[model samples]
Target: MPGETAPVGLTLALGRLRALGAKGLRVALPIAGHPLGLSGPPEFNARALDAGEAVIVTGVALGLVPEVFQAGPEGDVHSEVVWRSVPVREAPPADVPSLGEAERELAEALREATEVLSRLNVAGAGPAAQAALEAYRARAGRGREVLAPGYPPRALRVLELAQRVGALIEIAHGAGAGAGEHGAAVSASEIAARAEALRPVERTARRAQVAAYNAYVEELERGGS
Candidate 1:
């Protein structure tokens, strides 16, 4: 809104959303071959893919993906963020796994990924990267709400599993790619295989994340919390 002709205001944005007869927001995480939660007009899908995320307003044909602009010199740089709304189609939500199913799938994925890494002899990262990974795990383990209050607790569990899966993906990619200074690169064959194996898990992680983010809206649509 700040970049618009009328200038910025949250009220203006809310009013526009209300005028659209909005029901709730649905999250989209799109990637090639997998439009995770998007059912779209190509324009909206393309923008969301570029942004790597979007929010579609259910019960209406509209979506918003944010873009940030930065300018000015280093010491006094300026930046602005805008949610660029795009036209979308109102379609049935993408079929995503339930929390229980996600958890089970994530668990199996974790096991398979671990075995793959271990078999390929790329399971452990360099000391520094290992420490960083441990720190991240500790942070994730802290009791906290993964989403806003309106979302059910199961969403939190799914989010946590998704994050764990993401961590595994990172570890696989990092170890395979020789990320840290002290890290040794795995064989090209292993790297290729690792990537091939983790692709589905990575997609699952994205799907789970979108599901968790949109869970609140799903609940609202069903007339429940």
Candidate 2:
């Protein structure tokens, strides 16, 4: 078109491309009225296109229609009159998983983590929490069972740290879809603070148990069951 802008149309076009399963695309717009004329007196009338799905517009002017003889001089398709616009490339296949699925999975993770934290708060849950954590570890080792795929040892350590704190003080689901430039960041400070508070206590308790085990082991070595 004559004076068409590119933003809205480009965004919509990109959406269509995404729907078409394109992971990449390139759009080359004519530079104003010409397909190749420019301030830089270059030869071939156009610059080589760049990579990745980005839109580029060249501003050469076709002024008045050039002679048809000049159009396909050396097997060239079009006669050089002034400007020419190239069609946008189709998008590549969409290989990533659905964003909706990503969101749902994230939500479920938040819920599961909080549930685990909640269970750590009961009166007699210390030993039980330890046992559960051991079980959880065993089950997790068997396969990708909850928490997150390829769960890390640190994350479990975090869980154990949370258990010591009697309900990790911070897990929260922020309002709205957690995606975008203006997306909210959930704070881990509160949970961290709670964990810090319980860390000393937990460490102390853990040390005591370790000491008791060591004593028993020593006795067993000395012929004590």
Candidate 3:
């Protein structure tokens, strides 16, 4: 059951709550079909403990956890027996940065790369080189837009890295094209020099992206634990 996909409603609800930065959520178990929300087999309520536990485990795996309630006519007997001894909350260390903060750091690093590209002086460079530079600038603009908030932390990191890498490659290609078009105007050494200057900025962006991704995974591990 752990390997199986969670029911659609549970997945959607959990995603929504995480996006909203909610804490201390609770859910009623043995969810029935239609108006009651997600449905399981007829024996769902009979195996409420196992089913409910499975859902919670799955949620934890997805970087979220919700308190589950399975009350009957007497009320809360299940919780009293099972969850009574369990600690309800634990605060993370104050120094631990949130996913949003990590994302911002990565975005800033990528913006630095763009700034380096924009400042490069390619005056008198041939049309081919100018075209390549323009393309790289356009990609940089698009990358900034993609870095905007809303996506899950991991997804956002992946997207941002992809955008930066693409732009970098395009810039490299443009530099090569410029060199070829204006063999006299721009020496091969000039193109190489420009690329070398960009290398550190690109490396910085990559390092920041990796750090952000690691922070996100660590947060998930802590939440699951």
Candidate 4:
């Protein structure tokens, strides 16, 4: 069923989306307590928050979150992806910094993160952390587009920097037992210090992502698109 919302394949879900008179699409990346990229009715917000990622149909006030599973006799023969639809309500886009401002702020945040990581000896404290950061950087370099066509170059710049910030957060969070501010070995003051340095950077990264994702939609709203 192309019209069916749940238990729908990727192709059918896309067909259903095309059937809707959507003017645009926006990506939402939300975490608990901070609904970063969502502009929603409570139902849509709750679902996007639960899933951590979703796509909102611009003119339709509808959202889609994907749920993936494996299926087969042993539940491993094939993979399935379903797009679950949630009704959304119109809301203003989140207030995000301008591209230049975002770039400058992120540069400062990067310096701060680097200082903290250096002081704490956390840059490569764990091999996993280094590997993860490298992987993210590699992916960003390869993929190139932060959003679809019609967005400004600055939007892509912000998104890439934001991704690096996310990688920093992961580095700080993925350390081993021997790493400072990790596991039982962490001191209370050290843990607090780490959080203090990283929390704002994390928020900044989310803000940047929101700006990048909303760039095209904002343009449309402003008659630039």
Best-fitting candidate, scored by TM-score: 1
User: How many clashing residue pairs appear in each of the predictions shown?
Assistant: 0, 20, 0, 0
Candidate 3 global TM-score:
0.35
lDDT of 4 by residue, 1-225 (tens): 234533755676666677776777777778887787677777878888877888878777688887777878875589876667888777764446667778888898888777777777676566666776677778877876656777888888888888888777767766433444352215778767777778888888887787787777767867944
Worst 10 residues of 3 by lDDT: 30-39
Q: Specify the poorest-scoring 10-residue window by lDDT in model 4.
A: 176-185
Candidate lDDT (C-alpha), each: 0.73, 0.32, 0.43, 0.73
- What value does the lDDT take at residue 155 in candidate 2? 37
Candidate 4 structure lDDT? 0.73
Q: Write the per-residue lDDT of candidate 2 for residues 78-190, one digit (tens) a residue.
A: 64322223332223212212223333333444454455445444223344334444554675467542233333443334334333232222221111222321111224654
Q: After TM-score superposition, what is the CA distance of residue 12 in candidate 3 from its true location, in Å? A: 27
Q: Let me know the TM-score candidate 1 reaches against the reference structure.
A: 0.85
Model 3, residue 121: what's the lDDT?
44
TM-score rank order: 1, 4, 3, 2
Better of 2 and 3 by lDDT: 3
